[model samples]
Target: MAPRSRNASAPTKPLLKAPAQIGSLDAAALVGELRQLHEDAEDPDIERMPSDNELYGALLYAEKHAKALAMKQGTEAAQRSAAVKRVLLWEYLREQTDLHQAKAIEDARAVKAEWADLAPVLAVSTPNAAYNKAKRLQAARLIDTAHGDRRLRRTPEAVVEAERRIAAQALAERRAEEQARQRHQLVLPVAQRLLGHRDGLAFDTDAEDWLDEMAAVVDDCHTSTQQVSLARYLGATVRALARLERQTGKPPATTEAARLAYSAAVELLSR
Candidate 1:
């Protein structure tokens, strides 16, 4: 080492890149872009698969965005389904010791099962799951209270237990009612495209009919409905009509003609 080397070691470069370009991309932005790309690839027009590196990068980016979307959708769906479920539960509670109450509760239980099935797909995060689970647990407690068949009149012990149960039930009912009120106040417009409204008339009933068909699909996939066999069914109809309306494409003879086609297809499947 008689003469020290001019460049004994390579010049050290900053390990991190400059913050300017990266500033626009917070973690959430990166994830959302990746998801959009992934969803875009599902289109029929996309012929070739993206490279493995691209796919991997997209997946890594998507993780952060997952909880926000999943939880929001899950929560909204849960609240909507719960609105119907709770109403049914209330009716059942009032009719306890009556056979119809049992039947109605069974129906609500089925709806609740669907709510459970869908929640995981839509939940924003684990905390969303916890919240819904707690709500369900509270509802269960109320049902149990209304149906608790302990002979309170026969013994002091039974009487005390029944009173305690009543107190707990009262508290739960209040909480559930409050939740329902909060949810009730939040009225979101249903997707206009999904409802089949032209220039805005009351398409809510039509949408409900369509949704009922969707619910049936969840209830029984083996059976197809003219009404709504699959979630994709409505999506397909909407897309087809849009294509028909394209300037270069042939349009349906009339709006009535398009309606007939949609209605006929749904009715045939529903049967």
Candidate 2:
């Protein structure tokens, strides 16, 4: 048979095998496998190399799993921090009132309610602001008591100098308080105007127009302190409007009023 032609023989078919369970592998093992797959893919003689698409998919899944684990860890950490803060707050309340746990907790709730009530007056909008103010007030109390009767035995000149310093600090504090009060007064009329719009009591003036005018006035405030005060007042006003909305169940009016107030605050602060 003309020495059976070698080229006429049937070609052998390569055996197909199932892919490895990459998803079942741990991260390190998956990475190692991927590295080997990469090396195999780079080699010109290697057949049956892992597909680049499959390796990429495994890498993406691994990265996603790692991110999810990190997020879970972050959430746990935040929860722990919040729990610690609560414990510290409760302890502080107990020391202040010398109350047992039950009473202290009850008193703490009452204090929180009082803070809510004064939020509008003090222009304390956020929980963090209230917490910081509480800490500052505590520190001030400690400082005031630190000198106590120790200043009674100084020489005449020293006593006079100390008196002058005390007077100066007092004057500065009073001036700051007065300035804040004046800024608050400037905002009160705007808040009242908005409230009138909410209640349909403002004559012929649209709520939005009044809000714009108030914003213009805030923009005109030259000092940083004045701008900050206006922003804080607006934030408090928005919170009050929100509270009123909840009480009245008039979502449209209350929601719009809050939106305008918040926008005004944001505008002033951004400048």
lDDT winner: 2
In candidate 1, clashing pairs total 12
- Tens digit per residue, CA lDDT, model 2, 125-182: 9755544444333321122212442322212333334445667888998888776676
| TM-score of each predicted structure versus truth | 0.21, 0.27
* CA RMSD of all predictions: 30.2, 31.7
Please, what is the whole-model Cα lDDT of each candidate in the order they appear? Answer: 0.39, 0.43
Predicted model with the maximum TM-score: 2
* Per-residue accuracy of model 1 over 31-111 as CA lDDT, tens digit each: 344344434434232223233345334343333233333343334443344344334433443333233433443465567
Model 1: ten consecutive residues of lowest lDDT: 14-23
Per-residue lDDT of 236 in model 1:
48
What is residue 18's positional error in candidate 2, in angstroms? Answer: 89
RMSD of 1: 30.2
